[model samples]
Target chain A: MPEMTYAQAIDHALGQAMAEDPRIVVFGEDVVMLRRELYVRFGPRRVRQTPISEAAFLAMGVGAAMAGLRPVVEIMMVDFIAVAFDALLNQATKIRAFSGGKWNVPLVVRTSCGGGYGDGGQHEQCLWGLISSMPGVSVAVPSNPQDAASLMISCLQSEDPVVFMEHKLLSDYWRDYLGGGSRKTVAFDVPENGRIGKVEIPVKPFPPGKGKVVRKGEDLTMFSLGVGVHRCLEAAERLEEKGIQAEVVDLRWASPLDRELITSSAERTGRVLVVDEDYSAYGLSGEIAAVLAENGLRPAFGRLGTEGVIPYDVRREAKVLPNAARIEQAALTLASV
Target chain B: MRMSAETVPVEELYRQMCRAREFEMALARLWEKGLISGEMHLGIGEEAVAAGVVAHLREGDAICLDHRSTPPLVARGVDLEALVLEMLGDPEGLCCGWGGHMHLFSREHLACSSGIVGSSAPLGLGFALASQYLETGGVAVAFFGEGAMNQGMLLESLNLAAAWRLPLVLVCKDNRWAITTRSRTVTAGNLARRARSLGVPARRVDGTRVDRVWRAARWAVERARRGRGPSFLLAHCPRREGHFLGDPMLRVYRDPLGQVLEIAPPLLRSLLARPLSRLASRVRCLGQIGATLGALGLELLLEADPLERSGRLLEPSMRARVEEEARREVEEKVMRAMERRVSRA
Candidate 1:
């Protein structure tokens, strides 16, 4: 087992998937060079470089799928998806159904997303929310390396189009954390059998559609996802000294919510505090609160929505997004009020 | 009038033109009777180009169709009844009533007919990319009107297809008119020359004659399939009908009514004024147009069987099936979205 960061974990997963399927292609702006140098062992065809035409390239991937090839087309930045939305939402996603199920578009589209990066508004927008709203698309935002690899492999194997969103910050920061603290750092490790390594399991799947308890507490249930989950966990750890036993839960899947798990947890804890980085209204937290209200868990929704009309300026964004301090305050408030 | 698998004859080309004209007339009738909805752009005099280009294509090759490509899709083996029913908004239509006439799709024939004006250009390039990636001996063709040359998507596609050396054929069916604007009035320079500037082999074909179009298209298709990269063909045809039914051509063009009136004199008087050569030319043109329409009528009769029968075309059971499919698709989309949100969150 080994301890690896989230980014390193993603690299490991990408390497593993590439090694498994020759049909799987990794392509984007600097992907051909970066992916090859990172993997060093793979050919230039499987890992290709492309000119900056996102729509056309994405369409090329779609066309490639119709002719029986699995492709992983990367949009270097998620913001570029705006230029290729037509191909992504119309051509690739609708090919199978449009053709009466004659062909499946088995392709993976990867992009780096989120607002923590100093790249400012254009580069750091977490637009997965908009993509998630589209049909015939599978969107994955892996916070850790284990998920990055597993989810990517699953996407590569699936017969549908998947939008894999990798957080640039995590890729740059979390390689060792994904290693699971292993003595030997092999090229990559799959979590199976005796191959278990030394990585902290911050949270695991407790119940479907429900948040998992990172810590058992009689006080408040702090619900969050993505980086918010990490922040909430940090807050829970700090609050342990104040004797405010905070039970932090990671709301993994956002769309086909594990409604049962969330509601049951809320009912068990009686008091609920939802946290998120996206804005307040219509965000995941609001949806969760609505779901709870409809299902009998009237928990307090303490959403620490980022404060900004626009998403430019990294310093301002940092001040806006839900951080450890905000999470701790929200948790304390839920526990007391 | 010679014909082969690789080439269409003049007489056959005439027949295709007639078919396009009659089919549009029939479609207009359907629309008037409230049997069809949405909008349609007819390809009447452009029949020679559609038949010519498509004749050179094989089973494995794919063609991207614009809004004005009904006859090509039909000739390529799309079911006429399904096409008609789709226009009628029936659930059993090609897109299960999701796409109307302009968005006809036939998987069995590998034809993708779309409504978006310049969308096919990129998709066709995609097919070329697919062919190159898979090492398949197949070519992808794009049938765009002259007006579409201005679209950024098509222009970009040209560069990409050439850069990748993809096996693509870009057929610019310059049917003289894009809606109301004549190609001469809107486009700059020559179509083939524009393609040549992009490093693609370009050719000009007499789109009024089927055999001429067929020969040029065949050569381009073969060249592409053999990995010679992309080709562009400018097919110069004409527009006999208005952009759509009820859209009188007189308003768009200068004095179409006056020209029709001028030509409405006694046949004998005109013949006497022109002598034997002039009379012969007039007779031949009229005969060609008539023969074309007759052939179209026959083809429709033969091809329109499935959509005609009252007991089967849109049976209650069929409607139910379509509903079930739509519901299934919607639910699947919703569930998948939910799943992604859950897992990603």
Candidate 2:
């Protein structure tokens, strides 16, 4: 067992995968901060730098993947993915199906996302929902370091295109970078857990299409992903103080959602609360609600999420985003209902 | 591979161009018959450029094409029947009927085309980037219109290719019109200068002439194969069918007098509004109509079809035979494509 930050884990997994496979090549703007060690180690050919052209670079990743090269392309920010959306949605995702399975884009688009950092509306979006909604491609959103590394490895090894979303709050370096007005310090598996603070890498993969119930409970089921997983745990702790017995489940992947786990969990509790860091409308929250409805579970449902915008002011952002307090309050309402 | 470029077989290149032209002609017939859905874009006049450059391609070479992709795809030896079936929205077609003419792709040939105007550059650069890593010693060539050069991705691709020294040949078929708008008016600065600024060697050639396009493409592809980075080729050609099938402008090309009569009433109505006071304005308005006709005249003046132009390079008897063979081949493809099938594309 080893301890590493979420970003460090991404680096470790990508490095390991690249070491195992020479076909893998990394490219992005300045090779992305999360993959600095990769640039130093893999050098120019493997870990390449690019001009700030999201469309070209992203499509290049698609082309490379088609030509038998595993390319991990960093689009810099999840918001920046809009610039590369055409490449991702039209080219990367549809290449395999369009070419009659003759061409598969084994690409990993690593983009940093999520809000509560006060970077304003443009930069602070967690729009994995838009990507996940697309027919082809898999989206992996890791909640902790171990999952980040494990999922990163899986994304690299996938025979198809995958988008690896790195939440800003989950990254250790990003936390230090945006430390100015960040009120809530989210420490998910840190100094408190002696095992998590170790230098060795943990490659224990929970695997894709599986959700992990971090804190098991019986009263109510709380669904979350990315930074919201930590928020859900915090809310669960407070819910426990009031004897609510809220279960916290970390949904690591956005697309190809763990419907089996989600439906089973909802079936057990018969009540669900979806707390998401992204906007609730057509988001992961709505998706979970739809999944539940499709599976014939119409329990006491409640969802807490951003109102489609991440404000520039830190206080306003924290207030807008799904925090532990909001999650707890939402849970209380759902429990009462 | 270089020998393919050096010899410049006139009859062989002519046959390729003829095959592309006849294929598009058959596609046009299908479109006219209301078989193909959506906007039909034919690379009717760009046969020489496609045949010229595609002639130099080896087994490992890749191609990325723009909306009017039939020329390159035909030159690349993609199944003509499959192409026709794909256009007809048949399951046993290229791309399994998922992609139309513009978005056609073939993994076997390492060829792809997109309806997105400027996407060819990025997609082609991706192939070039892979070839660099694969060490296949193969070069990638992208065929796009001059209009696509304005797109951010194409510009970025040029910079990336030049900076990384990826084996890429950016072939810009400068039809001089971006859809309906004259390219020179909207297109800022010189195109060759734009490529030169990006550290790429650029050359402009007569796109109607296969010999010229062949030489230019051969030189550029060789430069890329040598690991010297990307090269830009501006092949100035004509779009025989303007922009797309069923373009309103096509009506203007056919029965110009009727079109003028259909069009002149609006201008004539303005003249009748104020007979004397708005005289100067009326003259200026007439000048506008005259300019449109002048543009049409300009289009007619450059009416040298690439297939016909290249065919003349061969002996008259041999050229006639080649043209007949190409026509028969395309006819057989159209017949096969029309027959129902439940097999893979």
Candidate 3:
């Protein structure tokens, strides 16, 4: 085990995967230099650089995938994918279905997502929702370094196309694992069916279909994902001393919603609050609310999310995202009611 | 193959144009009958370029065609029935009914065609890059119209291909019309000159003559395969029909036939007199069709009844089975194609 930043973990996984399989090639704009310097001390053959043509480079990745290569191609920013959409949506997505499951495109397109860089609209966007909606593509947005490593490795092993969504915000966040005596890194074997490791944090047994309760509570169930999970936990701790217990659930994976945990928690408290950074309409929280309603479970409190697109203003974005104070307030109001 | 060669018979070239013309007419009828769903962008007058360029390609060489490259695609060995099936949204189509006629690719034929303009050039470079990076001795040809010359992405591809010295042949069929816009109106100067400025040797040829295009394509493809770099072949031709099947283009551009009649009356008169020699023309057309079918080692659908149940070669049950079974078949074909490509390494 080793202490690794979120960005370092990504480098470890890419380095490990490429070493394990020669067929695996990594390429993107400045990825070769950045990954090599920041994370892995590897050669150019494994981590290749590409020209600024996103469409061409992406299609090259697609061609490489079709040619039996496990390619982890990076799109420097999530927004840039719109330029290479023809290759992504038209070519890579449909290769398997169009070929009737005959071809397996083991392609992992890694890119930095989310806001926090103050890079404006062009550089910051959580396109995970849009990408997850596309068929024949598996979207994974890891909240921390451990999940990033786990997901990147899993993406390389999967037969289908995977969008390994690495957020720019959590890149420098620190975490630890015991070092494997590996100052001089060597290739490690990968499991046939990729591995996904969960971090316990202040919670436990973080599994799909089951959300961990960060703080045991009976007042309200605070459901959130990614960075929102951390905020909800902070809010829950603050509300605990005020005699309002808010159970916090961190949804590690978004697509395969943890309905059982959500419904049971809603049933226990009779009140639920869903918080997300994206806009309220057509957001993940709306879908979760719809699911609970469909399952005959309604909470006293509803979704807390931005009404529209996140404004470029840093202050506005922070206000739009449900914070610890907002979550605590929402939970206490539901408890009193 | 010479830098200039007149290998195709002018009469045969005219017949190929007529085939494209008649095929488009059939497509129009099919659309009206509600058999075809999507907008059909036909390649009526661009028969010579397709015939010439495709005639130069070997079995393993690949081509990336644009929306209006139907004539070239057909010339490259895609079945008319399959193409029509695609237009009809049948499962037996090229993309298993997933991508109507607009997005068509056949691994067996080693060609990929798409509907998006300016995008195919980059994809073509990808195939060429794949060949070079993987060390496959194959050339990738991008068949684009003059209209695509102004596209930024295509220009980017030109720069990339030039920089990397990739094995790519960028064929620009200058028919002078992109949808409704004239090439002269959009392009700054000669398209060949544009390619030449990119530091690659380019030539302009008479696209009406299949042989000239073939000769030029041969030289370009050879240079690319040898890793000398990319070259552009600008085939100068004329539009003989509307931009697409439904486009009433006569309302826009002045009909060239009227102008040709005024300037080159004897040449126009000779072309007009061609139909009067009907019996000889019919025999020659039949012979050519026979030769083409023979070359492909396939029997003419007209010659033998390949089925016992009906006038069609395929029985209704079999056709239904083909439609039902096509999804799996396409998948298997793509997988096999991928595997075969991998084995080549």
In model 1, which regions exceed 4 Å deviation?
A: A95-103, A173-213, A307-314, B1-345
Model 2: lDDT to the true structure: 0.77
lDDT of 1 by residue, B1-345 (tens): 344644345444444444444455556555555344323467765666776777777877898998787878755656555666555545555656545666667777778866555678899988888888888788999998886776567787888888888999999877655543344544568767788888889999877666677788878888898899999998876554445543323222344565346333422232243123334554544453334334433433343211122113234665445435534543443344334434533
lDDT tens digits, residue span B1-345, model 2:
335534778888899998998899888777666555445678999999999999999999999998899989998999998888777666667866556666788999999886566778988899999999999999999999987887787998999999999999999998876654466645679999999999988999999999888888889988989998899999988888867765544556665776667556644543443223435644554564456546856785767877767777788999999989998999988887787643332
Structural similarity to truth (TM-score) of each candidate: 0.45, 0.52, 0.46
Model 2 stretches astray by more than 4 angstroms: A1-337, B1-6, B255-286, B341-345
Candidate 1 lDDT for residue B254: 40
Q: RMSD of model 2, in Å?
A: 21.6
Per-residue lDDT of candidate 2, residues A54-133 (tens digit)? 77789999898889999989876787687678998888889888989887889899988876544456567788887899
- The CAPRI category of model 2 is incorrect
In model 1, state the lDDT of residue B53. 77
Top DockQ model: 2
| DockQ measured for candidate 3 | 0.01
Report how far off residue A174 is in candidate 1 (Å). 11
Off by over 4 Å in 3: A37-42, A173-215, B1-345
